[model samples]
Target: MAELIGPRLYSCCNCRNHVSFHDDIISKAFQGKNGRAFLFSHAMNVVTGPKEDRTLLTGLHTVADVYCGDCREVLGWKYERAYEPSQKYKEGKFILEKSKIVKENW
Candidate 1:
């Protein structure tokens, strides 16, 4: 019998809690506060903080900080609203800092 495999995942670097799947990534070319980031269509095992408007490299956007549910570590942010039409695609998506996450089940 063939051995089964699990989905590749991204985990919180601080706690190793599963946060996202590799297949859910939308873009890898993103910038975060520390360094590189990734855009993901969905994230799990996370908590969103209060929403606030912030000016980013893209533009002004309503975003909420996302934390690791297990450890409460600040992982990144979720795009609640985008002011610019071109940036609207990011709405409801998640940005996870590369420095804050680790690969799992690879």
Candidate 2:
């Protein structure tokens, strides 16, 4: 069985609430060789769905999928550039701010 790596809060597809959460962890190097410059190889499944989707076509546009634990809301997402150079990935360029949180009154 795969180990839980990354308690990422995500919203349940069946329900709009964001209680359903999963951990995403990638220890391998997912750059250059991996499809699309670099990607989170090991835990790619966690962020990406099995089947590709329309518009995105691939449905693997997710760099990071942050869901809410309380309301199961799709809090935020981080997209990645496939097969690009590693330098393209700016350090500390990605972040999840406190403002992204949607506090419900209920």
Candidate 3:
């Protein structure tokens, strides 16, 4: 993909306090309500508090929730394998591990 002109912030779905962006993309991450709205929703965090692993999310134990730095909104989540306690995944990382995006305002 071509490089975007601004910073980009990506969040995790399972854990509400976690958020990330390339050290190089911090500024562009704060675009607006349209681009950063998902960062503040439970749909992204999965649960407001601790959540027991569901059978459907099968094998997903460790959940990392994330949000935006500027508005402190929900952005996404990252799910870790129940068997493997590591960060590396074969198919690349899955950000926003379980949340759904209802709108694309941002």
Best TM-score among the predictions, by candidate number: 1
Q: Encode model 2's per-residue lDDT on 1-106: one tens digit a residue.
A: 9675544543333343533223322221332211222122121112321222212323233244434444444433344432234433422122222333222222
Off by over 4 Å in 2: 1-64, 79-81, 86-99, 102-106
Best-performing candidate as measured by lDDT: 1
Residue ranges of candidate 1 with Cα displaced over 4 Å: none
Error at 71, model 2, angstroms: 1.2
The residue ranges of model 3 lying beyond 4 angstroms of the native Cα positions read 1-58, 80-94, 97-106
- lDDT (C-alpha, whole model) for all candidates: 0.98, 0.31, 0.34
lDDT of 2: 0.31
Each candidate structure's TM-score, on Cα atoms with residue i matched to residue i, is 0.97, 0.25, 0.31
lDDT of 1 by residue, 1-106 (tens): 9778899999999999999999999999999999999999999999999999999999999999999999999999999999999999999999999999999988
Residue 79, candidate 2: how far off, in angstroms? 4.7
Q: What is the lDDT of residue 70 in candidate 1?
A: 100
**Sorted on TM-score, highest at the top, how do the candidates line up?**
1, 3, 2
lDDT of 1: 0.98
lDDT of 3 by residue, 35-74 (tens): 3322222222233323344222234455444344434445
**The 10-residue segment with the lowest total lDDT in model 3:** 24-33
Give RMSD to native, each candidate: 0.9, 12.4, 10.9
